[model samples]
Target: MQNPATTAFVSDFAELPATASHGPLRIEYRWVNEAAGNAPIAVFLHEGLGSVAMWRDWPQALCERLGMRGLVYSRPGYGLSTPREHAVKWPVDFMTAQARDILPALFGVLDIDMQARKRMWVIGHSDGGSIALLYAALHPDALAGAVVIAPHIFVEDLSVESIAQTKALYETTDLRSKLSRYHSDVDSAFYGWNDIWLNAAFREWRIVDELAAIKQALLAVQGHDDNYGTMAQIDTIGERVPHAQLVKLDACGHSPHRDAPDALNEAIAAFISRQRR
Candidate 1:
């Protein structure tokens, strides 16, 4: 199988004007298995501090396993994409805006027509997972399915604690320097996510009600050892979207794709196969 990570260095760019007055955002993205014409597309949304480089070869591996093409991108303020302004603070509804506005515009810019949209599948992790859920909710008919790993449907004390700790690490530890390798503006990626997540108002952030709007095949996966969120996250998803499937992996941390790649891939592959049937 061709390694997608090798091609990540040569990313494509698109300029999407901010919905607010924040100016145009230069989005950095890459396509995997584009040669696999007519195959379904799997859009991979990265974690809060993740860039396309951070995904390594997981997207390529998964695409090869499923015989699908893949799209992976660094959202604004991440990777080589336009960095977030230092003075600006992300609103509590930031993820929602990404789902409702940014993603659709990206699809348009990339010429992901109606036919392609119908065959689109989203596989998102962490913050990306939340965005995927919101996107699926906003356009229930647009996506074929979605697999969210360690998604946040509502705020939790554990989540806040872990985020606060991460912020401390970013400030004091070499985490910033390490992360800088992946992002052009490392602070833009780190603080943009950390600040909003630790905000007092962010504690009230919840998407449980909004999730009820999603009608597509949905799978929520989380790790047993995930420190960022608890099982309640996926449990709430199952409650709101009764048809949504849930998977829990033992001995795994916040990132199931990294901690349990084989298991995660098998679970997602099975879910997609069932959806096709």
Candidate 2:
């Protein structure tokens, strides 16, 4: 699949912008649509191995469609964000790091106190989807809603297998070279993510149980023919979370947004519009 163009979405010249205090490193981000005049702000979290640049223009399209502001950036070790220790792998509580530390830091830098400011929407894909759920669980009162695409609630054999294949490609093919354009510390970002998921400890990891704490309206989407995760991930979200909905697209893969943007965006826009009411 072709990576999207998101460098254009970043604020060309900004200072001390958003900061995610994940470990010793702080993430830098570009907050979009700050002047949209009360529109919803969508915080976009990228997939594993995905940086802001890799997400391309999807945030732009979603923000435009939802009449919302947007925030997009690389995590620590991704894109222009600061890199972290090579030996210090993402802890078992990596998602927790994102939910408790990173999300709040981003909001702080953007001067958005979710308690006082307009509640925002979250659009997350793959690993981002899991992070979105964690954010919702952490800040149920602050979210307007969430759209999680191809999320993993629990680890799966296929998920690991797919990551292995991707690792092979990254080593043998031009995958790393391609990802390099998107991430300033591409190796750190890639190995940090890859090693964690492939770790034996991560196989039993599951967030579906913890996500029941979330009160925000939820929309979980997955492709039936997904190469990584199955539609059961979305089903798990719907079963465990209150006011949750699911959409299983046929002939779709792990990346429904890239594989079926029109259908994906249409479903997302509709879902977001309904949540506002």
Candidate 3:
């Protein structure tokens, strides 16, 4: 496979060229125009540490399978996007901040038409999944469907425990250094997410009820062996949103997208295609 650094993508002004603001925070993103004509736009929202480059070829493969247009981007403080300038933890309403403020700014900057598009599909992983649910809940009519992998609807003891382990790895192991090479501002990305999940106010963070407001088709998937969260995370989505369908992949962990790429992509394409039909 050709290196993404050298891939033959239809060259255009690449990632993070657009600029927008959500309150005091600045957001950045990338836009890609696939030749697949008139297919629904498959927007990929990355996990907390993910960026446009971090998604690798998963977005391309999914878009190709569905014959769809696509958008892949980094959220604020992740990837090539702007970094958090302070040491503060994430806001309790961080998901809401992404949904209500950052998302609309991205669409506006990229000129994505939520009203006229035949379908708007979001495939979000981890923190991005929560943000996607927030968007779907607020604008149920704006999206056709969404696929959430390893999403956290309610904070759990296990989640905190796992994050604590990762924090230690950051301090002792070379995980932070390895990640630093990938992210331009690794501290901004890591602490922005890790610190928030570890904060006191965030312990009570739960949006299970808010998701019921989303009437659009939804798919929630998780792994049995996920170290970061439990099966209850995905299961709770179905309990709250009657329309939600759950899929569990055994032996998989926090990042189903990376751990089980083929299965993850297949499920996403099929779910979006099924909605179109």
Which candidate should be chosen as best, given TM-score against the real structure? 1
Write candidate 2's Cα lDDT for 1-277 as tens digits: 2223324444432234444443344565666656676766788988987877777777777788778888886777777677656887887678877877777766776678765434788788899999999988887788888889998889989999999999999999999887887876678888999999999999878987788798878889999889889767887788888589888887789888788888888998888778767
Tens-digit per-residue lDDT, 143-217, candidate 3: 888889999898999999988888899989998877775466788888888899999899999998898798889
Q: Which sections of candidate 3 miss by over 4 Å?
A: 1-28, 116-118
The regions of model 1 sitting more than 4 angstroms off are: 1-8, 18-22
Ordered list by TM-score, greatest first: 1, 2, 3
- lDDT of the structure predicted as candidate 1: 0.90
Total clashing pairs for each candidate: 0, 2, 0
Tens digit of lDDT per residue, candidate 1, span 201-257? Answer: 999989889998999999999999999999999998999999999999999999999
Q: In model 1, which range of ten residues has the least summed lDDT?
A: 1-10
Best by lDDT: 1
Q: After superposition, how far is residue 57 of candidate 2 from its true place, in Å?
A: 1.0
lDDT of 3: 0.77
